[model samples]
Target chain A: MIGAAQLLPFSLLGALVGADVVSFPQAMLSRPIVAATLGGALAGNVAAGVLTGAVLEMVAMETLPVGASRYPEWGSASLVGGAIAGWHPVMRPGAINHGVFVGIATAWAGGWSMYALRRLNGVWAERALPAMEAGSRRAVMSLQLRGLTADLFRAAIVTAIALLVWTPINDYALAHWTVGRAAAHSILAAAAAAVAGGAIWRQSHGAAGSKWYLLAGAVLGVVLVIVA
Target chain B: MTASDRAPTTIAPALSWSARIAVFTRMFAVQGSWNYETMLGPGIGFCAEPALRELPGGPDGPAYRDALARETRYFNAHPYLAAVAIGALVRAELEGRPAGQIERFRTAMCGPLGSLGDRLVWAGWLPFCSLVALLAFGLHASPLVIVLLFLGLYNAGHVALRAWGVSTGWRSGLRVAASLGSPLLQRGPQYLARAVLFLAGLALPLAIARVIGRRGLEIPSHDWKIALPLAALFAIVLAALLVRLPARVEGWRAALVVLAVLILISIAR
Candidate 1:
């Protein structure tokens, strides 16, 4: 079991990053790559963090976060990924795979948590209506601060719960999983590639001149890769 | 008198520099208190509070109360783009415009600003930056470098947009909508969209190739093994079907489908 002392910093980090998604300071620090890296850094395993983050980043690419539509919550989820990968430390076969799996699972759960938090916020907003209607400065500030605080705690709780639930599972999977490194990596890379491809296809399929533009970008990327 | 005609008498910049800063800072919390019913309504009113407090009528006055109630009705837009609306609304309030005109202006701006912001930030900019970060990470760049690159590149565009949006809206009020329609905004997302697609195409193949190469998979050069290629072709076809399906394929479903295919491939081998 991960100690509370060890989990505390990551939980806080999750809160800050989660809040960044929609609440405040939307500086993209909440992106899976960044959040996972930070989580890994705190856990003393940067490389594992990078690996987990890169995979999660590909999956996260498809999410648009448009308007009020519910989407995967990447911030706390990446923390879960990075923490698991970091705790394992050893680059055993399927270690990164376990991290990715846990990360995706956490993200799925995080989506539901976000919906619930929104509902909670709705309740608080409802309760604050009279003062807000009266233009009470204290009331307005309190409501905003209260909403932000609620989000912070929600993220923290989600991160803590995900870590508690998944760390042992990841540890067991890493120890017992029979998948070869190359096979696991291949499946992961292909899956990520396919998802990324589908997202690009969805975005560019209808726009005029987008096909040509996509072609040009693809060529440029290939040239860069070949040169490097 | 027209809102603009009576502007000189009533719109004497009641907001101090500090008050403007407060408003701008509050813009960050425009969605802090969001709810489905009002959908940013309360948050918008909350953001406008600092300015509302500073209006000629004190906080308890009818004007301030009216303005606050007017803003809390219903409002929803991209938080970043809503800065423009906030700035314009501030001007409207200060100019003593009718609440109806202000509400109409805000309601009108919501759809366009929201859509434009969604297209530019979400669809265009995010994917492009994410691909760049993915490529950087894939190439084994330091995590710090990758993080800095993603944050720096993304925020540079977004912060500039937010600042420009507010200032432009302040200067032009509702006319700022026309300015947002400029070719630069229109072409920016289009170009970024193309770049994102291109990056995905380039990155996906290369990633698959690297994994295959690392695994020492021999196909064309060694045994003319067609299984991998066939599987890939099948995956592509599946992906195409998912994309074309009338119903939206949730992310998890797509992921499950991909994983299932991989499992089948592994079993077949």
Candidate 2:
């Protein structure tokens, strides 16, 4: 079991990255790949972070954060995934698979949290309206800062909760898993590939001459891989 | 008033270099106070505060208070493009334009700017960069290198867009919309998106194949030699079919179904 002290840094990192998603900086640091990598580093394992990040990135490709749409929140979820992948005693063949599973589940939970956070923001905004309507600059600035602080705490709590719940579940599953190494790799690869392919398909499906572009890209990719 | 009928307004060069910097920095928090009713209402007001403080009469004056009130109205846009609106509004407020006119201008620019930013940044640039980063990761590049590559590629465009949007919107006001909505600007990202999509489509299967090949699955005979190519072909076809499916099939549902099938196959084997 990971110590509470060890989880603090990850929780903080999650808070920063989560706030980055729609608040301060809007840098892609909140992205699953980056957040997961940072999470892995905090947990004292970079390789586990990278692997978990890569898989999560493929799954996240299908998401499009447009307008007020409610999509899965990958930031805190990736942190949970990376921490689990890094801390597990056995770096089993299905480790990445398990990490991806936990990451997806966390993301779904994070999505709900995001919706809740938005509602919370609405309440804050409502309370500040009298001062805001009076054209108080201090009121406006304080409200904005308060919202950011709330987002930070929201991400931290989500990451800590997810870690507390999923870490034990992941460790137990890895210990008792029956699938052989080869089969596990093959299954994960196929599923990841299919998900990625579907994401790509959705992206280019309506565009003109998309099929040709796919073929061209495939050929180029194959040639590059072969050469390398 | 008609464009020519209005007296020639002197552009207030009053916003000092430091004030502009402050506004730009504040632009980063344009979504900080996001809410359902007002969306980015308070955030927009927050960004304009620095400029309001810098007006000729200073912070607590009527002009500053009016400008602050003007900014706090319902406003939302792509966060990146909000910089454009911020710059334009700052310029307008500094020039002492009517509060109503500036608000109308902000409202008018939101929809077009939102759609344009959405297309360029979210749909085109981000996925393309992610694909490039994935390629680098697959090739065993260092994690730092991959991180740098992803951030550098995505932000180069992102930072450039924010700077250009602000500067251009400041100078041209509503006229800047013409350049923003130009087909060339739109098509450039679309073309890049297509190219990136092609590369991703090609690379994903190759990566999957490599992973499968590395696992060294045992077969009864040489019959398993065909398995790799068959799997690759099936993936490509499956991708094509999924893409061609009706919009009713959500991406998440498709992914879950595929995942379930793979799990079932693994368990049975």
Candidate 3:
């Protein structure tokens, strides 16, 4: 069971980060790196949070949140992942992998919650149509505020619930995990690299003039990596 | 004829700077009430309500009601460029344009606004900034610096875009199409897209290197062990670059499947 003290702040953090996804102030504090760091800090493990976030960020690169398309809600979900990983604070394989797996699940659920909230907003809009048609300021404010408030609550609840449900699972998985560190991390890296590669291909393939830039950047990247 | 019969000579006296500020600030929440039926229509109205209340007849006036009601109708645009639509719409409203003409303008503006904002912000600037931040992480930048750099750079560009959109839209009004023709709108996407590709090219290798370097990966002290992994990772990335993904399948989605199977394998073990 999560202590109430821990639950409240994390819930609040999730709410704020989640809201930043599409609601108030899209300042990108919801980016996996930022959100995960915050989540990790809250859990007393900043380095672990950053490492888990870096991995998550790689996977996230493929998501293009365009035109209200259903994409993973990485913000609060990453926070949950960060928190899980942070609690252990070990540079081991299973903790990071377990955190990431749980985060992905949370993000998947968060996406659904967002979809549901949008539907709810649709219903509220239908109900408010008559008053809005008459130009009721009160009606407009009510719908807007209600939608915003609901999104916050949805994120908070999702984060809290994911934490409660997954903490034990993560613990158990870590406890039983028999994989070696190199094996576990190498596979994760390969998968992440594959995802990044795919994303690069998608962007450059039909675009004009971007390919050349990609080539030049690739050469430069090699030099940088070698020198660094 | 009433004094109201005369068209306003200037927009300034009719709508003050303060009103414009209110509209711009509210524009930040332009996606707050996004829904399937109206998309951002309600959000557009919410942002415009303050300005609508400031119409010639004030909040209680029929004109205010008409403007608010009209704005509350179906409308959609990228959240950022919606400011442009809102600014232009406000101008049309203040100028006493015919309702049909204003509606047509709003309809016409949506597609362009959506397309432009998507290309510039979503497909271009966002990816470009993300890659830069990723590169920093690969180079071992502090987490705080990475976060600050990403947020600061991204926000500065976007907030400026928003402010510029509102100002330009208001200035151009119904002729906002001409403003859209500016090099910034037309050429900005191409430049940013290229930048993204460049950064993607540079950052991705380092990313793979970082992954390979993580503590979980163990390699013997042999010099070849170090070089071998890098070479292999590079080859894999190159193959990935050449491989075209079928439509509707993304890298992450495929990775997730692979990951899930791997997780099962681990748990089963």
TM-score of each: 0.89, 0.91, 0.93
TM-score, predicted candidate 1 vs. hidden true structure: 0.89
Candidate 3, true inter-chain contacts retained? 0.58
lDDT of 1 by residue, B69-188 (tens): 777767888888888888888777777777678888978988988998998888888888888888776565678898898889988988888888777777776567888879988888
| Per-residue accuracy of model 2 over B95-201 as CA lDDT, tens digit each | 77766678789889889778877877887788788888778776767778877888898889888888887787778654566767667677866686686678687
Worst 10 residues of 1 chain B by lDDT: B216-225
Model 1: per-residue lDDT, tens digit, A92-198?
Answer: 65656666667777888888888888888788878878877776667767877888898889889989999888877767666666655555665666566566677
Kindly report which residue stretches of model 1 are placed more than 4 angstroms away from their true locations once superposed.
A219-228, B1-14, B206-238, B256-269
Best first by DockQ, ranked: 3, 2, 1
Local error of candidate 3 at A166, Å? 1.4
Better candidate number, 2 or 3, judged by DockQ: 3
Q: Which residue pairs does candidate 1 place in steric collision?
A: none
Candidate 1 vs 3: which has more lDDT = 3
Quantify all predictions' global Cα lDDT against the true fold. Answer: 0.73, 0.74, 0.78
C-alpha lDDT of candidate 1 relative to the true structure: 0.73
DockQ, all models = 0.46, 0.52, 0.57
Model 3 CAPRI quality: medium
- What digit string (tens of lDDT, one per residue) describes model 3 on residues B24-140? 888877878888889999998898887777676788777878888889889988889898988888877777777888889989998999988888887778777788888887787
Shift of residue A174 alpha carbon in model 1, Å: 0.7
Q: How is the predicted docking of candidate 1 categorized under the CAPRI scheme?
A: acceptable
